[model samples]
Target chain A: MGRWKNGILITYLVAIVFPFIFLFLLSMSSGWRFPDLLPEYFGFKNWGKVAGTESGIAQSFLISLVISLSVAVSSTLCGFVISRYVSYHPKKRLLTLLTYFPYILAPVVFGACLSYYFLKMGIFGTTFGVVLAQFIIAFPYALIFFSSFWNEKIKSYEDLVATLGGGSLTTFRKVLLPMARGLLMVCFFQTFLISWFEYGLTSIIGVGKVQTLTIKVFLFIKESNFYYGAMSCCMLIIPPVVMIYINKKYVFNKLI
Target chain B: MFLEVHDIEKSYNKEAIVSELNINLEKHKTLSILGRSGCGKTTMLKMIAGLTPIDQGVIKLDGVRVDEIEASKRNIVYLYQEDLLFPHLSVFENIAFGLRIKKIKDHIVDDRVIEMIENLELQGHGSKMPHQISGGQRQRVAFGRAIITNPALLLLDEPFGSLDAGTRKNMQTLFLRLAKTFNITSLFVTHDLKEAILMGDEIAYMDKGKLKIYKDRSSFINDPETGVLAETEFWKQLKTEQF
Candidate 1:
């Protein structure tokens, strides 16, 4: 049983590590000879190019940043606010089910179905259009994540605050917001990462015009630029990794 | 009357939760309301605090009709059973929250909170967060937070219900001491009969949305159906057995 457990652990490690090793190596490889066990050339040329202002990689990074940050901040805020009301509603289950509809469905299918609306609104091929599309997916997740936060105890706390002479604003600022602060950060990063890695929705809604990091990655692959694609993938993985590290290290989620 | 609930009514789905509930509590008096679960004790407390709306009644505080007033402006503090201290805030900060919101001076807030910490016997633990404290200490912080605001009415819903027996007893004693010191006007609701007897100056019993306030504590103790009389008799018999 011990050996079997070790075997499973090793398999899990390899499953995760191998792709990272390949991606790093591919990104660094200046040239790889055909039928060779290893690359004939190795350099940081692809990585440099991705970071350099000459390549559109930096612009794609900024675009993805704006879209992700917007989606994250807005969705989390709206979700936190709305979920409180929704949680106590008579049809909460049905409303929550509605929220899951956009997310649980295949992203490409979801995007394709909503593409006509994007065009009709003239938001297609714009940054706002892509951000809005991702928000649709991310907001529901925020709702679901925060659905259970407002229980009877929290309701009592709200009353406690109100009765202590704190109005709605103060109740939220002093009690609700502070209490859910860690979860807010979690939701922000989760939704940010969701918008960051999103390709299908951006493709369909942005009409391949709004160039986010994921779009750039696909462009790299489609153009057979494997090194740059690997470089983009590496860049794409950084934020979430940093976020997860912060979440584990710094955030205080719950005492009990 | 310091606080009055005149013909208050509430219903959910056509089932009355509190029907024509009426009570009066004089200033600086503690009323301990005893009831079983789902007996509308909590609802009545919330109604008084303006946290829950009353269907058909007026709630007056010191000659001012406050039922129409928003809960935030009511100056009534409700301490829940679970302490509900803000986990992110230190004990001092939690106690100082109401003062800070009122834009009280920094030194004044600090002085009051420090004094309260000492009074509550929580001197060194002031800087610690709510989660860092024991359950009994946390309840003390909640009490401090509510009382420091000098609320017109303090409503406690089984404030020590989550504590162990020893801690509960200690907290009850501390509460009574503080109630005397501050002369706090309060309405304490609990399911425990002994706790009700110990906590309140005037005892009231509630069942099925109706409340019966005993004019004297002895009458409340001596009431037949409330089980207190039988409980007292049992204790008397046990004393006889001991002798």
Candidate 2:
């Protein structure tokens, strides 16, 4: 039984790890193209060019970080408030479900809708527009994660607190917030990852000027700059990796 | 009068859970609601605690109409079967929850909580989490949390039902002593007839959704049809054997 379990674990690891390893190798190879089994040469030039000091990597990286962080924070906060309202009020169930409808809509369709509104609002060619678009895509993730967390034990605690003469807001701040700290962090990080990796909406809404790393990478691939494109792909993986690491180190154990 | 329940009715899905229930409790008295399962004893206690809505009745504490008041504003505390102490909070913090909610000053809250901990014999356990304590200790903590606010009504929904037999009996005695010392009005719900007899100043027998309140202990044990005395063999044995 143990051997079989170990075998299954190894298989699962290989399934996830092999692709990234292949992608990393492809990104580093200097002279590889189609019809070759492997790359002709492997070097650090591509990585240095894309991620080094002068490649505009630092600027694009900063923009992506700022946009993703803002979207994550705003969406998670909004989701927390909305979920709490729906959970407590009970009459707002229909409205809460309606708020989540945009998340279920296809990304392309929602992107189209956002573009139309952004044009009307004169935010079409701006970073704020991209952030707004990403926020919408990430909102439901935050809502689902935090709502489930809130629903699990917060309701009962709230009732207990209320009976103890703790008003709603005070109970929320002292009891609910402390109990749910770990889950809130998970929601924030989850929202950040979703916003950061969101290519379809970001690409569509960003159009030509407001470029994320994913967009830049896609554009490079289109132009057959596979070397830079692969490097960008590797760069795109950095945020999620760091996020997962931080989550494992800090947030995972604290969650109920 | 410390607490009064006037003609409260509650129903779910068109089925009445409790209908036309009335209770009047004096300060420092312990009233126990005894019933079979699904007899709405818990529901009645919850209504008194403002944890559940009363469909057609009024609850007043010290002559204030509290039927429509929010649970936090109503000065009635409820303790659940599972203790329901905040798992993340230390015992002191859990007991202080109500005080903090009332926006009491920091020193006062500390003083009150410390006093409760000492009175409840929870001196060394103040910093421990709920999960760190035994079942009996947890109930004591829950009681401390509820009573720290000095609520006019303290409702216990089988508060000691989860403990072992010996622990439950010990807690019952401890709780009765605390209730007397603090002059706290209490309504305790239980399925155990002995527990009801042991703890109650007045016994309320509930069946199906109706409540029958007994004004005296002898009346509850001696009445022919509804009496616990008539239903118990030990009472019969004692009646014949002791005489």
Q: For residues A19-45, could you state the per-residue lDDT of candidate 2 as single tens digits?
A: 888778877886676788878888776
**Every model's DockQ, to 2 decimals?**
0.82, 0.65
Candidate lDDT (C-alpha), each:
0.89, 0.82
Residue B72: error of model 1 in Å?
0.9
Q: What is candidate 1's lDDT per residue for A93-172, written digit by digit as tens? A: 89988987886679899998888898899998899999899999999999999997989888878888888888888888
Question: Model 2's CAPRI class?
Answer: medium
Clashing pairs in 1: none
Clashing residue pairs in all predictions, respectively, total 0, 0
- Worst 10-residue stretch by lDDT in candidate 2 chain A? A145-154
Expressed as tens digits, the lDDT of each residue in B68-92 for candidate 1 is: 9988888888888988888878899
How do all models score by TM-score?
A: 0.92, 0.86
Supply candidate 2's per-residue lDDT for B40.
Answer: 94
